[model samples]
Target: MLTIIYEDEQYVAINKPNGLLVHRTRIAEEKKEFALQLLRDQLGYRVYPVHRLDRGTSGVLLFAKNSAAATPMVQAFEERQVTKTYYAIVRGYTAESETIDNPIRPDKDHQHKEAQDAVTHYTRLATIELPIAVGRYSTARYSLVKIVPETGRMHQIRKHFAHIRHYIIGDKRHGDWRHNKMFLEELDSKALLLHAYEMQFTHPFTGELTHIAAELPENMRRLCLSFDWVNAVTKHEKLTDSPV
Candidate 1:
């Protein structure tokens, strides 16, 4: 069942799980069922996706109940008015707080024409000292972070974090293979640690501000529980210091 996080006359938002697609995509043809389809089935009505979450991303996903609402919500995203906050377990001890303002370009021959401007703000919530063997006679440590992307781009969080040298754990495509393999073999975790925990935006119909939040999944919760800085960074009710 979908965990309804927020719902109103014009839109309904839910906490989407990891491994679910927001909608059909040409790249993932094997996905016979999608979040949009499932949501429509569960609600017994047609719905429109206001924004997209990566297949591996788990957290607040907003869906407009009708076309008129979807258009404005999409415009809000395009204008970077929507606020999003995410938590992630990365591969190193990050600084207390930092902001990454870099522009990303599509790789050669890939989809999209130009390099887009991407900005992300991140704060180190806590650092864990889990000792794991890396290559020959080497032990490695990693950190946990709360990330907020100011501008949404394709894989902005993942790509930006990776570019900063602290790739998120379990991000295979742009992550350190050694750390990925270590987590899988030792910790038995295969899913990416990134979670979209909180979101704030204007209501399409009422124009009244709205806020939605989702708790971290069991795996992430448990992982954070095993650390000390967890209480310092992870226990807060909100991810962002500023009001949405």
Candidate 2:
């Protein structure tokens, strides 16, 4: 059964596992299981997705129980009223906290015409230098960062981090192949190290503020443990002054 973290008369939140699709997709036609199908069958009722997470990502995923709850909740996401926190394992240790305010556009011939503003805040949580031989030296370094994207865009965090030369580990589509291959061949893991850990927003049904979180998956925890960084990282959050 799917892990239902929070539920109400109007909504349900799930700790979606990595590799599950939110709904049926032609892109993933080969896969028979999906989040929508599984959850709906579990509840024997309809559920609406309020937001999306990449297929490779695992964490808190929200769903509205009925159509009534879906509209306003999705609108809230579109308007940037939600605060999301993500934890990602990336290549290399970042020296300090940084905010990336670069704008991105669609990957089309007219990419310039469809540009959108993108902003992301990132804080380094922990760093580890593993003595694993890959390419250059007898050691490789990795960093964990807590990321907050102010603007929602397709692959914003992944693209932005890659643009700055700090690729998220295991991001095969936009990562350093050498490092990714090293992880797969040496570490026996192939999933991207990104998790949508937490989210905060107003309850569309109750009008009260709400916060939801997902525990770090076992694989991610294991990765952290390998580096002895499981306890070194600290999590911090603040509410925006704007009221619900």
Candidate 3:
């Protein structure tokens, strides 16, 4: 069963697990289970997705209990009124805090590829250096980062991080293969490390400010614990405060 993080008469949210699609798509037709289907079945009613999270991302995914509530919620996201926070484990130590202002293709398809303005702000919350070596390096270094995107283009965070060469760990498409192999083979960590940790927006039904936060998935939490980043994992204030 999906973990419901928030619920109301007009909206409901779930801590969507990694590898679950929000809805059906032609690109992944072979996949059967979806968050939309599972949640609708669980509630025995229809739900409308206000926004989408990547299939590999896990965290607070909100759905409107009815279509009336979905319109304003979707509009809020389109107008950049919603504040979304994410956490990621990346390949190297990121800057104390930085803004990535770059352009990215809207989607992976090459047919209509056009670069669009995308901006992402990130702060490094924690860092760790391990003696384990994957390639030529004698040690491995990583950082836990808090990410906030000013614009929501597809794969903006991943691509922007890749642009600066601090590849997000476990990102198969745009990450360091050596580190990915090391994590999979040595650490047995295979899921993408990016997670949608929290979302804040005005409630469409009640006109009240709403904040929803999801706990880290077990895999990412365990990895953070192993790296001695317990404070970073447990404290949201640290994620938003002065960078480490």
Candidates' lDDT values, in order? 0.83, 0.85, 0.89
C-alpha lDDT of candidate 1 relative to the true structure = 0.83
What's the TM for model 2?
0.91
Give the runs in model 2 whose Cα sits over 4 Å from its true position: 108-113, 234-244
| Residue lDDT tens for model 1, 1-244 | 8888888888889989888999998788888989999999999999999899988889999999999989999999999889999989998789899999999877655656878888999988677666667866356778878888999988889999889889988888888888888888987778888899998887767878888888776666666655544465544433232221
Each model's RMSD to truth, in Å? 4.3, 5.9, 3.8
Q: Which candidate, 1 or 3, would have the higher lDDT against the true structure?
A: 3
Which candidate leads the pack in lDDT? 3
Worst lDDT run of 10 residues, candidate 2, spans 235-244
RMSD of 1: 4.3
Q: How would you order the candidates by lDDT, starting with the best?
A: 3, 2, 1
Q: Write the per-residue lDDT of candidate 3 for residues 78-156, one digit (tens) a residue.
A: 9999999999999888899999999887655664877888999999999999899869999999999999999998888
Clashes of 3: 0
Stretch of 10 with least lDDT, candidate 3: 235-244
Shift of residue 20 alpha carbon in model 3, Å: 0.8
